[model samples]
Target: MSQIISGLGGQSLYGGLNGINSSSAIISNTQFNNPLESTVDYSALIRVLVTILQQLLSQSSDNTTRPTPTVADTSNNSQPFNRSNNFNTASNNNLLSAASNQNSEDDRNIDFNILSATQRDQLGMTPRERAILHLWGRQVISAGKQDGGIYTNVLGADGTGTNWANKAEVELVKELRAAEKQQFGGDTGIFLDQLYFNLVKEKTGVDMSTRYANRPVHFSSGAVSIITDINLLHQRTGLTEFEQGALRLFGHDPLINGKFDGSVLDYTISNNNALDGSRNSSGNPIDKVVRQLLNEDIQDDGQRNGSSLMKSVITILDRLYSSN
Candidate 1:
């Protein structure tokens, strides 16, 4: 056995099995003669061989069949993350759409054509009356008064009695002169002084005189007198014939009262609130007639062409003077 072992390159039994030399497991000559010692070496070698066989079996099992390395499918693994990202993107888009819709709703809530009750109360006039006065004031400002002449003469009271078109025209002219003197401080140049004062008060909340003190040229002017002449006033004001006629009839309708009432003149010229047909204080659609008039005047292109505005004034007059 020793010769066979030496023939195998003097390797121990355990070393031979593992393709290595082990001096401790090598059978010695003296240990082989002692049967007990030889038996002890063989037993130790058997134990080591058993341990190596067990290790080899474990290694073989590990090498042949691993747990398949549990390789993750990246495509499947990223699905939840991708889904999370998509969900987040969709949520953001929904939020943006909601915000845009809210903004549009807010924009739709604004109604520029309608005036509030507080605004009507502060202006102390009906919407129709305010619109009429605003147009009239603009006309007066455009057709300035005469310079260096009796204001009454400029208003068709030349005493020649030739300029008077009719008794009605003559009466209207007299009422205008009286209103200019009594309410407007005889400053016929500043015909609609109250309108100007109200506009200044609305804008600056200051006295009209204080605003125009440094700029008196803007306060009053003598450019072209046209208040007494309807045709001339129309030319200056760009008001249509029907509109001018409506305003004239509003001032003096012989069919309604048959005479010029100073109270009517005052109410027409002053900023006093109109009691009749002024119930649409909130500018709501509850007053369909007034709301329709406002819609036509403010929303329609006919307002620019003077057709709708004429209709609005005519409707108001028709309501007031039922005979017309």
Candidate 2:
């Protein structure tokens, strides 16, 4: 209950120049100071968080079947009690009450299931694959004094790059696919990629040919700071998670080569060649909150200025059908 971000999470406690800004910040910075915390145990933290979520979801599901109890109408409690009659209305009332509470909780759980699954798929992840997407490590690379010694704007632990696992999606998929085919193949990222692609298409009819056209979809900026540490779990948090995810995506995977592969880069220049007529078929919904966050990072200039906050949400669908 200390509210400290502990264990194996990728979140850094460094306050940048903010200096001791929050209690959570202080705890995280301590880890940074200690060389022992340099190791990144992704499996441990992921398992812990996933277990907690599963337990909560199970409880919620159980609540849905709980029987509702009627409130005691105490107006007729004058009846005498015998050894057998001890099972009075009071006991019955308590049972009913408990059941009703459970039912209410179940409904909430159902809603959460839908929402979480939807968001994950939109961002390209499956139900089982939905989690803190990150290739976490203790690599704390500060931006140096020129970039403020720590990109304060880049959210998440050790800058924004350490949070989300927006690793070259295609390369990751290839690795996973190879794992599946070969004995050394690890089907982890590949299965995740497939699951995500299916979910988004089911939810939204939009396709890659329509959305990206020829444009490249970079999650964030910088050579290594493309993926946001915001995690798919909290990407819908808007100014909080939205910005963070964008940072992670672009920062970790910028269009360094300026070359766009049709399958790899969904956006393109259609025959019409117009931005306004373009319809993004992918799952990335430009919510009001997302707009606000992007506005903070992006500027309104034809020159395409600012910290290049125009981040892209790389849909997993492309990889599933990409020629590359």
Candidate 3:
């Protein structure tokens, strides 16, 4: 894996991915590494994303591209992350322009939210970004009820959060922590901190730093109901070969995408029997998901035509590498 990343080191992955013929197959770019020989062609995976990205960017002028406007242009496309401290009053309205970027990056918004008031605002995340942070944290650990009403009085709000959509997925974990040994019906297992591992990681992108996001959630029931999507428990209780390999590289397990009964998280989150796949909505593998999608680049290589996403990746990777 290291060798693959190393070979592509300083190389613009977005360029290569974006360069794939827009008319060609998306799966062609997303091909994977060899499980047996560590020989994988990331191009195939890139293709899948390229198709999506192409579709997205192509819609810049086509209002009919989808039912709604491209998220960045949509005033309602708020990110699910709620790390209040880092959000700037400015990011709420405008998206960082993509002209500074090359090509591959014009895909998703990479901005991140503030950690807190006193926290040095590092990444400068945008609004939709804030939502992803919130989404990831909610799915990973149980969520407490949030008094989202604070946003209700705002200029615009969309789709009402139904009971299932509004309830916390990991609410059970919190309840279990306070439960007695006998309340569990068996030996006590799992720690509270462990429950929030990816939650914190997703929020801050610091790889499970001791510092935690301090947002408080207020439940609608007046009591935060603790319920593990029974389906999530079943899938995570055992690991798959692909999942195990991902965990080894990324340091965490992925979430269940469908229930044993074969239901999607959309249904479950809104009150079905399945857990959403552990991945962020972007469909990136859960474990390897990047935290701050920093919106810049460092490689001056003329060989590269930096796309928006490429710039974000390069800038962030460079920043992290240099900080060390």
The global C-alpha lDDT for each of the candidates, from Candidate 1 onward, is 0.35, 0.29, 0.30
Candidate maximizing lDDT:
1
Candidate 1 C-alpha lDDT tens digits along 5-52: 434443323333343235223633425666655555567656645665
RMSD per model, one decimal? 29.5, 32.7, 27.9
TM-score-superior candidate, 1 or 3: 1
Cα error, residue 280 of model 1, in Å, equals 24
Any runs in candidate 3 off by more than 4 Å, and if so which? Answer: 1-194, 198-294, 297-324
| Candidate 1 to truth, TM | 0.21
Q: State the lDDT of candidate 2 residue by residue for 159-223, as single tens digits.
A: 33344344343333344444544632222222333333343344334353344343322122232
Give the alpha carbon lDDT tens digit for every residue of 21-139 in model 3.
43244333433565676444557556545665565455444534456555344424354232222324344333333312221121122222222321212223332333323333332
How does candidate 3 score on lDDT?
0.30
